[model samples]
Target: MKLINWWPPMLGTGISLKKVSKDMTTFEVIMKLRWYNRNLVGIHYGGSLYSMCDPWYMFILMANLGKGYVVMDKAAAIRYKKPGRGTLKCVFHISKSEIKEIRSEIDMIGKKDYTFTCEVMDEEGEVVTEVDKVVYVRKKDFDFEALEKEKEAGNTKIPG
Candidate 1:
């Protein structure tokens, strides 16, 4: 995907894509918690805070894993450490070599799942949120004939 299209979502929300690596393993995005992103208590809006991290890791996964594999968010968890003031930054990093390894495994075993974790840090480098993402990946083409056989035996339910 082009960086131009990637900028709007972030800029629209007052966030910025500060950096993205050539290997697609690491990215840095920044956000300024303005009035629109403030809660009743004047703290940063939770949704906006969460938005700072959206799609970055998944994008990285998609870019590195190549085609014929499915990469999804799967799940996420965030820890609000200290309240954000001024601006906040989320630095996302993945291991390109590790992704290569995962791809190798998927090619070898046909199907495999992997998890990658990244941290969002404030300017002081204090982690504001720690996110763990699980992604399921497998070869796109599988034994459809086996599935058909199972269906013929009434052991499977085919979706209409």
Candidate 2:
């Protein structure tokens, strides 16, 4: 988590992780409009807004679903609604029931793709950007438990 906190792109864009729930179901991120991150007109950069939102969904799903699943960020799109002049915050949340639903869908289809929407808001709570993220999830074919046991025993090589 500390590694993520100091991640170069996030740091460069002035995006900070405020909180992450113990279960990884919720994450809060804030981006301050600093001199370095501001565009020529002194507003937040569009790329910065998108970077602020890039990773949370996949991170949350991976943590919640554990090693038995493969989770990836399949696609994303961001729409700039207004110029962000100050601090902007975005919260990402995925409920246990949602996780259950995803699992059910994956079990039924062998894979599932889900779209999540998030709104980035300014300090005054006006929407600054809208982001849509599509994540892909599927159960892994290998035995995760055995892999964990092997790693714990200091056997790094995978059996062919």
Candidate 3:
């Protein structure tokens, strides 16, 4: 979590990864309004608001989905409900049962789009921005353990 807080994009935009739950199911991020990140009107910039939400849903899914599945961000839409001036924060969480539900769906259909909504709120606890994110999840077609075993035994071939 500390390393992620220092990530270049987050640092550049004054975003911070504030916390991660012990179960890896929940994450908190904050963007404090600053001179460098504000728009001409002196409120939070749309890009900054979008940036705060850009990558968290994918991460939440990845942490819960495990190694046998592939997860990628598909699409996003942000609706700004009101002007934001103070610190803005968002919480990203996916229940373990929800993860299992996603896995079942992928297993049954091979691949599918899953959508989650994240809301950015201000100090007064009113929503300032709403972000809808779509994630693409698919189960790996081959056994990863078997492929690893083949590579360890020097029997796997690679195309040059």
User: What lDDT tens digits, residue by residue, belong to model 1 across residues 1-160?
Assistant: 4464356666566777878888888888887777777789876777677778778877887888778877777666676777776678877777867778777776555565566666666778887766666667776775657766777898864432
Ranking by TM-score: 3, 2, 1
lDDT of each: 0.72, 0.88, 0.87
The lDDT, on a scale of 0 to 1, for candidate 3 is 0.87
| Segments in model 1 whose C-alpha atoms lie over 4 Å from true places | 1-9, 143-160
Worst lDDT 10-window in candidate 1: 1-10
In model 2, which residue pairs have backbone atoms overlapping below 3 Å?
none
The TM-score measured for candidate 3 stands at 0.86
Per-residue lDDT of 107-156 in model 2, one digit per residue for the tens? Answer: 54456688999999999999999999999998887455665776799875
Q: Give one digit per residue, the lDDT tens place, for model 3 in 40-109.
A: 9999999999999988878878888788888899999999999988999999999989888887766655
Residue 23 CA error for candidate 3 (Å)?
Answer: 1.1
What TM-score against the true fold does each predicted structure earn?
0.77, 0.86, 0.86
Model 1 compared with the native: what TM-score? Answer: 0.77
